[model samples]
Target: MKNKILVLGATGNIGRPLVENLLARGEQVKAASRSGQDVLGAEGVVFDYFKPESFEQAFEDVNRAYIMLAAGYVQAKDLLIPLIEFAASRNIKVVLQTAFGVDADDAIPYRQVELALIQSGTPYVILRPNWFADNFHTFWKAGIDHGQLAIPAGDGKSSFIDVRDIAESAAAALRTEQFDGQAFNLTGPEAFSYAEAAQLLTEVIGKPISYNAIDDDTFIDMLTSAGVPADYAVFLSSIFYPVRQGWTSVITDDVATLTGKPPRSLKTYAQDHRQQLANS
Candidate 1:
């Protein structure tokens, strides 16, 4: 009913906090999810990438949009580009959350979406975040509960960032036109190999957590066995090639640049989420 910030994946790890950050700043928000579930103090609406009709109401009267793909959907370009074009047609500002390192190749689906946004003749900011520290309590939580994180990362290191910093950065981007048309690669202050990360987790949790370097096939098998779709499992395994190649180890000041505070270290993430790590 008011000029609002439309936040997709409104109930997600990043979206929830981003919505809160906007609300804290006294901005109106329209929080959207597939279920149209209510978010804290924000107008709730149903929005789905698979449903184009939902876009109109979600975009109605909204001056800015925080666009990020929901989990488990792999066709990033096909799903996001059209929505981006629609927003561009409406002259709505866009802050897109894409993956780090996608810029190295134009063939990358996320990169294609970025290119589309850049050429869309609309105000846009791209946020390319590195690996998330919350994965310990999420995607890999099962493995941590089992005391071993089995992946194909081998000895490579990644500067894993907390989702909170990402949310803060997105809120910052959406609130201002200063960063329009610029892309920032968000990352943590330090990088750690899976082995080093496991050691850190073990120290923080006082429990023995180990990192096992398996081949991609084995990693895919583990995910498929865990009920992940075989295609998605394989897709997940393919992305690990960058981790194994040491490409994900880069650190950046973008988070500090955007949020005016340093990104949280992995140790801080572990210590703060120790309880969740062990049980959630």
Candidate 2:
């Protein structure tokens, strides 16, 4: 396999582009998903976090890995810790993607995983990315389509990042050792409140879009009524606390620092995904 890199969540937002970036750089990659589906030119491997037996072939002959927990797995530590232990035991380098506000706090499951990596005696890099601009076309697309971008963010802002920049940054961390033992907060160049974001989308998409800042209770009710799990709904609503507190509004140069280019702006993101937004 030529010391391939193992990329978990291989078909996801970051994993897909990360795999493509590595291949473009002439590096061997093992693209892993729960289904073991083929990812373009890379070798395919089946990897399920809930099924530990699948980790062996996925990690076989792998020198490094890009690790990201799947979305909505609030009990992330239960799944991630085992994988980290296995990778550390194999002496494989790890690049972990965690939430933006997660830190070394033991109470947070993702943070617990971060502390595990930090104390694992293995080389690793941590990437904490802010809110994704692509959410407008993915998670909140229905709201956008309805011309009402509603959330519990109040008047706070977030320096929303592009998944492309995150992919490039992950590739850099995986391919190089300079970033080992370091953590980077990847964010866009500017921060925008929901109202401001709605304005920008309106301008770029050539349509009216409104931002409705709702209360936490109302937000939870909406998600629950939409068939989202009650626990996960509360979890989703909890993250907005930071947004409402202005904690997510911090801008950083880490994207450019790692990728050697400025992160994409909201306008650029909207333009690139114009057809998707237009359809919404």
Candidate 3:
């Protein structure tokens, strides 16, 4: 068997496109999810963060792997470190997906996982992506359908990146050693406040969508009331601190630098997913 690239979270927003891109370029791919469901053009394997028995089979004969923590798992290090260690033992290069602004800080859960990767003495590249523009169609679609998007981002802006760019960058890192031992802060072409994003979406989808900037407590309460776990809701609201503080309003050329093309804008993303935005 040829050495395949193992992509964890294969059914996720970033993994799906990453698998597609790699297969298009003639690279072998093993798409791993909890269900072991196959990507359209790739082999499928069962891999779950809470289930360690699945790791060996998933890593078998794989030369490189893309690692990402699935949603609702706050203990990123616990889930990620074992995979990193196993990959290191097998000499498999890793391309890890972490949120933007998480660094080698011991306090931040994701950063602690990052520190382990760096200290493992293995070949690795990290892609820290900004808030995803895709969330408009996925996580926040119900609100969009109601003509209102509510979050606690306040008047601050975020250079919300399209997940496609993140996948492209991950593919590049996995295919080459040029960016090994480095981390890229992937972002879109520009920053936009929630209100501004709403305006752009309104224009593209031909509807009046508004952004409601609520308080953190209110946001957490709303999420919990909607069936989101209280701890996870708190986690979600906590991350928005950077956005409200204007820290996330950063734009970078990292996506262009890695993919050799400009990242997609909010307008373009909304236009491409207009059907979902219009109807969802």
Candidate 4:
């Protein structure tokens, strides 16, 4: 029988690609999202984390689920624990997209969610991926277009992984039992500071883009002035503090170990998105 997997946040950066990868592998998929928009021919199911009653319907007949909490949603604990309980009751295995540096006792809300999932007694795989390279194209595109990659990260280097690699790893874990009950820290093959990343983008796009380090307050101001929410803007800026301290600079082989191929390099990513960089 073909495996039935449900992907939460289905239209998101990782979730969208993951759905395509799973479908290509001939797996049956139900793509669920807040809007429940149709995704690459997969069955679409409406799911809003704020509404717990909508979850049971989405979980019906799902053997496994790719779980990702949407940003700017309600409390992660309130949303995830109930849904996890429902999945446990239905015997559905869960694969969670988490953050790097999260441990059982970590103070981060996402870490707390991971702890809950593990203690729920349901089979699960936790993928703690490093910062994403696509952030340059998506989140920082405006900055790049403006000739600067302004961030609160001062001299911080990260092992930014590609979202596609994270998705492929998720698909691999969902298709087999080898990765059950495991926590994988996914990272790119190499680490690069924001300035180095800017230089690479500059070279690829043939423009003079540069990284400008700013204090957290200035970064938060920029995000808010650009219409980002206060809480989320603050949270996003706060993460760079750790990076500024060199906390996330290590490379790892987890992506290769899971996908049977080395994770894509920043150069490859830059080259692939050269057009975007050029247009910027």
Candidate 5:
């Protein structure tokens, strides 16, 4: 029987591609978002993480779910627990998109949500993906366009997985029960510092872009000045402090193991998005 998968946040960076992949594989997809938005021709359902009432409708008749909690949300744990419990009651599997370094005892909100899912007794696969390479186009696009990538991650390297790779892995996990109860730490094939990434961008986009390692306060100020929410800007800057301390420098092959191919390299990403970088 073909699996019926519900992809929450289906319009997001990862969810959008995952939805397309699943549809290509002939799976039945219910694409759920806050506004009931549909991607391509998939079924659309309204879902709000802060509103528990919206979940039941979204989960109805679904055999599996791809879950991604939005950033800057305070009710992740509360929202996820009930959703997990309800899914478990209905015998549905869950593939949860989580962050690297989130464990059962960690104080981070994602960690708490993971704990809730585990304790709910639902069949689950946890994807602990590192920072995304697409952030160059999304989060850091302005800086890259302006020829300087400024961040608080001073001299730190990260294995930034491409968002498409993350989505492919999610689709793979959702399609098969083989990876249940396992947590995979997904990363790109190589680690690159911000400076190194800037160099790659320079080569691909034919411009001299540079990395500017600023203090956390300065980084936060830059983001806010660019009109990012102050709280979200601070939260984002706080994560980089760990990177500065060398927490995110490790590369992994889990992406290859899961997707049957090596993860995309930073250089490849830079080349693929050269137009955006060039025009920046």
Candidate 6:
């Protein structure tokens, strides 16, 4: 239990790598997921937001924790506040991963959770990451298989960040107290609209994948037809309103500032993940 760090959502895109980054830096790491299944190089523990009992076990012997909500659930405030409070009670430093633009309004659930953390008078660093470039492989892979990407995002660009940059940022936050009580908006090096992103994918994966700017109703219907939960699909569709309104196209140096290297561009993300993007 030597200066251990508990990483909730450890099996996820950012968590897994954040665990790796910390272990590489010689930190004792606890990787927490729903299953409590062991990661290769770190101890694993069970953690679920709805299960308050799991919090004590997950925080056991850990001096710091990275807090985040898994995808799908929208009641972020209800799910996150308890965990934040538990960590605060233990005086565990928190590095929270909430979405970009949440701080734009205090009414936002994630922002509210953030406020709770800051007001708790605990050491904390908030990392607000923009859209993930990995979504091309995870969320839109089926559309790529079908040669199209249908989303409600109109002619708008997003500075989609690589999840690796996010993990590194979190690791940086958890490794030191210098940035405590501060927040960083993490984004990639540049912005690209869905159409432009699709073209980059077409070149990287060697396929003609097109972008279809459908309406919100059509987007929701598409996600629902794809077996996504109806409520969650609507939630996903609502986020695109920011994209269409030109809010997500922001670029920031926070990634480089956090990790001491520049954030990867979309083209680089496509090139690195071409195999996943190419697969059906």
The model with the greatest lDDT is: 1
Q: Which stretches of candidate 4 lie over 4 Å from their true place?
A: none
lDDT of each: 0.94, 0.92, 0.92, 0.88, 0.86, 0.92
Candidate 1 accuracy as TM-score: 0.98
Q: What is the lDDT of residue 19 in candidate 4?
A: 98
Clashes of 1: 0
What tens-digit string does per-residue lDDT give for candidate 5 at 1-280? 5357999889888989999999999999999998897788999999987788897899887989998877665456777777778788887898998887667347888888788788778899999999899899888888887899988899989998998899999988998888899889999988889999899888888888899999999988887888888888887887887689777888888888788999998888888887876774
* lDDT per residue (tens digit) for residues 140-214 in model 3: 998899999999999999999999999999999999889999999999999999999999999999999999999
189: Cα error in model 2, Å: 0.4
What is the lDDT for 275 in model 5? 84
Q: How accurate locally is residue 215 in candidate 1, as Cα lDDT from 0 to 100?
A: 98
Cα lDDT for residue 220, candidate 1: 91
lDDT (Cα, 0-100) at 112 in candidate 2 = 86
Residue-level lDDT of model 1, residues 1-280, one tens digit each, is: 4469999999998999999999999999999998898899798999999999999999989999999998888889889999999999999999999999999999899999999999999999999999999888989999999999999998999999999999999999999888999999999999999999999999999999999999999999899988999888988999999999999999999999999999999999999999998784
The TM-score, computed over Cα atoms with residue i paired to residue i, of candidate 4 is 0.96
Error of 2 at 109 (Å): 1.7
Question: How far in Å is the alpha carbon of 24 misplaced in model 5?
Answer: 1.1
Cα RMSD, each candidate: 1.0, 1.2, 1.1, 1.5, 1.7, 0.9
TM-score of each: 0.98, 0.97, 0.98, 0.96, 0.95, 0.98
